[model samples]
Target: MGSGVLCIAESAGNELKKSAFELAGVGQRLAGALGGPISGALVGEGISGLVEGLGKRGLPKVYVVDDAALGRYTSDGYAIALKAVVQAADPAVILLASSAMGKDLGPALAARLGCGIISDAIALEVVDGKVHATRPVFAGKAQLEVEPADLPVVVSVRPNVFEPAASGDGAAETVAVDADLTGEQIRVVVKELLEPEERTIDLTEADIIVSGGRGLKGPEHFHLIEELAAVLGGVVGASRAVVDAGWRPHTEQVGQTGKTVSPKLYVACGISGAIQHLAGMSSSKCIVAVNKDPEAPVFKVADYGIVGDVFEVLPELIKAVKEKKGL
Candidate 1:
């Protein structure tokens, strides 16, 4: 296995994304399996410092493409730059995080490089001398194994799914390159970015998540949910109905249209667990549901189910948790 691994790094808000480092950890393992070194690639404006973070995760070389034109993300420009680096590196496997930017850039790079692409790949391994990718199919109801019969297999790994590997004394060798494409040459324009709330932990990154739904009755009821989240050291999430009702922001929604999370534990209160909602959080390691309706779908996949009014059950649950922790 002479093929090396290339892990793409994503940075924003001056912090190296955990997904980037975790995917590199995966790439490191894959590279070792293939008897080669794993390298990381980062492209953006004034992003040279992000290499130290990647380097600690066992990444040897970090390719940087710094250009003012790349200050804001554009699929066409990023795709062009990544394709150039990937071509130059000639790695057999390329890994990217499943962020919004990644979803746009990864496929564009694959198309530019004329390679088969697999998106939202949860698990990856070598199969028959090729990359075997496992991804959700039929809208997360089933899994599909994708075997790309091409060079440089492109895979997008979901956030928080792979934990970042422990650090080593790995130092980064920076490889500088030009943007290679101009802004005038690109077709799309990004006027603004509606950033998410910074103080709250992103649902995809939360180790523990407590979600609320219609049972909460009104937007003000989210206070209880937030209180419980604060106690559990977790994030507060909402179902689609609550979001559409304007009780919660769309960024806090957890469903097929929103972010997917595979946390160590997911506590759903009042949510009836619509199919779309389950599609997003079903992969959670453990689920706890509290609902008045005994027939709610949330209990079907729940490891622990409590049939009672959410208002009554949530307070009790919070009290029990606090007492357990001596808080």
Candidate 2:
């Protein structure tokens, strides 16, 4: 049953999310490793031409579930549509981003297909024609290796850890599948998505993130964090303490209870790297910890460390980056 791998394309604002490319890269590589073809599945309105971009990212086939029912995300609609396509494609491996949407639907789809599902994977490999996944367990304290015994192994992955992939010479070939709605009534109808107080880059997809904590002192000083983020073309993030204290918006909080981040550079300002906080960003490529306390757990994982007050250090760091880039 080793057919191929399919990554569900996700939208970032109006276009394809970077994580889509990352998964396409994974799918393409896995297909090559298994001597199979790489394919993708697209579900949404007005995304016909979107498959062209997917083809350029190494997808040979783009299965489109084009219908009015797919205009908005309804759990049942998505599960039904995806189930139809996957059953038609007969794929042995399916990949999805470990984001809110993927997390919401992966398990439901897995249950529908009667297959094993793995989520929030940090690493994946196809060995001897079998998919093996590694993911954090016990809140980032340890990791577990999961080898599904089912033919169609469903995987949801952390974004940004996989290397960014460039365009390829592949062409998009469309495949049509009949829609089904077996669980449509059982799914909750989402009325609306909450309007973010300040819509910034999603923590999961940010290239650079500057996060603050209780050490930022108060809500008024978050402006400093925002200013630094502006200087660096990064997003300002915060710990749960800061968000719970109303010092910053909950949208900016990065922790187990909030959004998970895997940026190229995750600069922790005044954060002590609580396990809950580490669970969100421990997968980042490069970590920099800036805090007054020298022995903070954040420093242990930091590639670069600055043992100083964030208030005193942040301005200097911003000035240096600006000067270094001649901003």
Candidate 3:
């Protein structure tokens, strides 16, 4: 029988990603409920520095597969490496973050192991000695509770949904494993990586997000949104309408057809909240809506509503934030 919970840790530039910590916390809870220890699996090159931190964050055991070929992310290489870890650990439950890497790896790994997988899970718990997961469905319109049908179940959790586990005094026992993957096994190779010039926090991982809509008038007015987000130390987001208008990139668009974000504070500027837009950010902890239209749909879900023009309100908000921060 499978035993314990194993969390697949993801990293970038040799540092653990935020999703890794979140999934670790999820794994910790599942392990506690199952009365078993939680372990972590890291697959990358020169990632030994991350192992100690993972251990401190309540993981008693951490499996490391540091290979030069695994430095850059590829589906086959990562999948094969993770397969080796799963075989060694023999975990009852496998948890991964619902990031790009996790989404790709979770299903592939599950297919290889012949186990049921729950993807984009927002919540997980042990009910009646079985793992039960809650995830958004129907384009974020509703949520469904699911239980994996097979042993050694796999789950990919949504990023930023779960709080990270706190640090502890216990040191993690590190175990290095050999995947022994050959050149032919890795079909896809990354030729070049082109990063964006202005690096902003990922929308899925940002704590505070300030989003704009068509009310901004044109693409040139986006500076108003950017300025406010800068003062608040938050990322800038956009409605699908503006994205469709070519005012902003699709990467910044938030809606049923775009990325889903659950930030701590979501500020909607000039947005007339369509259901599709709300589907993406309705799960935010606190929503502040600013719009000229008093009855805008976004105001319905906002914790605080401001019936004012974004151009007029944004400058004042930015000034207040700067003053408060002594910037």
Candidates' lDDT values, in order? 0.86, 0.86, 0.89
Q: How big is the positional error of residue 122 in model 1, measured in Å on the Cα after superposition?
A: 1.2
Candidate 2 clash pair list: none
Q: Worst lDDT window (10 residues) for model 2? A: 180-189
Q: Which lDDT tens digits does candidate 3 get at residues 1-327?
A: 787899998887667888888878888888989988789999988987899888878888999888999888888888899899999999999999878778888998998788889998988999999999999887677899999777798899888889988878768888999999899999988778888777779999999999999999999999999998888889999999999999998889987888888899999998899999998898889999999999898999999999998889999999999999999
How far is 239's C-alpha from truth in model 3 (Å)?
A: 1.8
Measured with C-alpha atoms, the lDDT of residue 8 in candidate 3 is 91
Q: What is the lDDT of residue 236 in candidate 1?
A: 91
Whose TM-score is higher: candidate 1's or candidate 3's?
A: 1
For model 3 the local lDDT of residue 222 reads 95
Q: Point out where model 2 deviates above 4 Å.
A: 181-186
TM-score on alpha carbons, each prediction? 0.95, 0.96, 0.94
Model 1 residue 87 lDDT score: 70
**Residue pairs whose backbone atoms clash in candidate 3:** none
